[model samples]
Target: MVRYVVIGGGIVGLATAHRITIDQPDATVVVLEKEPRVAAHQTGHNSGVIHAGVYYKPGSLKAGMCRAGQASMLEFCAEHGIDARVTGKLIVATDAAELPRLRALHERSVANGLPVDLIDGDQAREYEPHVAAVAALHVASTGIVDYAEVCRVLADLVTKGGGEVRLGARVTGLRRDGATTVVETTGGAFVADRLVNCAGLHADRIARLAGLTPSARIIPFRGEYYELRADRRDLVRGLIYPVPDPQFPFLGVHLTRMVDGSVHAGPNAVLALAREGYGWGRVKPRDIVDEVAWPGLWRLARRHWAYGLTEVRRSLSRKRFAASLARLVPGITTADIVRSGAGVRAQAIAADGALVDDFLIEQAPGQVHVLNAPSPAATSSLEIAKHIVARFDE
Candidate 1:
């Protein structure tokens, strides 16, 4: 029987394994995760907003996958009895300067074939009474769910389908032996007919380990968040976002009403010292060396130094963070929010100093490497699995 080895236990890896089990029931599938449990990193740390395909560029991989993934994700949730809610989202433009960008986003949304409406401030107020907006794009299909729960369910399904998910199995090396690839791990070595690297933050490293040169390097960006106090959660009924600056890839700090009904805010992007760095205090020398050694890092910094400084300032001060949110909802104040957890994004930067804005996947002989998949990845996890599995046949 054919055997496949998958590295990383995030949503993508588990979903890929599950797809393999379903598509090739006789194949032996093994999943290797360094952490002791599934969803220990990115999948567990995100804000859990199901994207409505509003922000991606038209005709991009993200736009197509996200639109299809939303429906597949909801169907899976319904079949598995996972609690998910269609909360809808509002992209608000508080000032005249932002109106044009908001309008452009509306046109892009329409082009992407999403159900979006451009509403005046009064109409936006009907949805979110406290929101301050000159105009807003209301996307009715956006939703929220606990992705960690989704990961857990995917793990269960993989196991039930005869796949093995081994935790605490960190990969140390990779080699090719004849027609098979040998994956060396702390747990032991396993040989497989094919290998899939969904290592998220460590994807570039994994690609190099597999004897392939990737087009970009993964740069870690820590996204710090804040949650409203229990009493203040009522201020947000759903998701409320600001008009994103077109130059930057991040969708600036915004408020999201989670599955549990708590409101989360402020995920300002800042450079991380380590691939898994969740805070300023969590620094690793090797990770720092990797960043400094890359020419793209310096080039990227030179271009966005001003914006980076602003993000750092926001990360350091709760008052400044709250002030940014207050632009959307006038009543929110520093006293209403408390420091919550943070997540590190595995953003890819090309050698030319440009941020890779699309889902990047690299394939080589007997191996596939997922180089970049940041936001909307969780929302698009199922469809991404199908896409990857189809490659084996190709």
Candidate 2:
């Protein structure tokens, strides 16, 4: 029987393992997760938005995966009695300067086959009454779901499909022994015909453990958030987003209505001192040293220091952060918000300082490494699994 071992028990990895078991039922599958539970990193720390494929380029892996995955995710959630909502999103252009980029996004979304409408300020206000916008793109397919619940269900499916998910199994090394791959983990060693690395925060390190050089280094960016007070939830009708700056990968600070009726706002991206650093105080020495020593970090900083400094100020000042949100929803105030937890994104940056945009997957002898799967990755997990499994055929 074909033996496969998937490392890093995030949603994508779990989905990959589950897909493998379904495709090759007689094959043995094992998932090794360093955390005690699944999706403890990017998957669990996400905004839980089911992306509608509007922001991505047409024909790209993200566009296809997001479109297909959202449908699959909805079906899966329904079958499992999970809470999922198709809360349409509004990508608002607040000023005349943003209209061009907003129109470009509309064109791209149409090319990607997503149903989007360009609505005027009055129409935009009709959707989200508090939003201040000159024009907006109403993306009807955008939605949200609890990805952690999805991961739990996927783990159960893997087990029921005759696969094994081993928690607290940190993979330390990988070596090819003849046609088999030997995975040395904290729990124990496992022999497999193939290995898949889905380690989110430490993905680059995992590639090194397997003696493969990854294309980019994972730079952790802490996305700090604030939640709307319960009484002030009406300020946001649904997901309200800014027309993202084309030069940056981040979608600017905006409002998101969670599945449980709570509204969240602002996830300002700033370089984290630690890979898993949720707060400024939770710094790790090694993570800091690695980040400082990386040449790409300097290159990136040199180019974006102006924006970087602004983000740092916003992080330190509650008023500054609230002001950013007010640009989208003019009614929002600092008192209406409460400091919430943060999530660190494993953003991959090239030596040239360009952030890796698309899903990055690399392969070596008997091993596959997911170097960069950020943002909509949770929404794209199932389709990405299908893509990963197809790599074996090539």
Would you estimate the TM-scores of all the predictions?
0.99, 0.98
Clashing pairs in 2: none
Residue-level lDDT tens digits of model 1 in 128-244: 999999999999999999999999999999999999999999999999999999999999999989999999999999999999989999999999999999999889999999999
Q: Candidate 2 — worst ten consecutive residues by lDDT sum?
A: 245-254
Alpha carbon lDDT of residue 350, candidate 1?
92
Give the alpha-carbon lDDT of every model: 0.94, 0.91
Q: Which tens-of-lDDT digit does each residue in 286-390 have in candidate 2? A: 998978877888999999999999999999999999999999988988899999889999999888888888889999877889999997889999999988888
lDDT for position 236 in model 1: 92
lDDT computed for candidate 2: 0.91
Superposition-based RMSD of candidate 1 using all C-alpha atoms, in angstroms: 0.6
Model 2, position 351: C-alpha lDDT score? 84
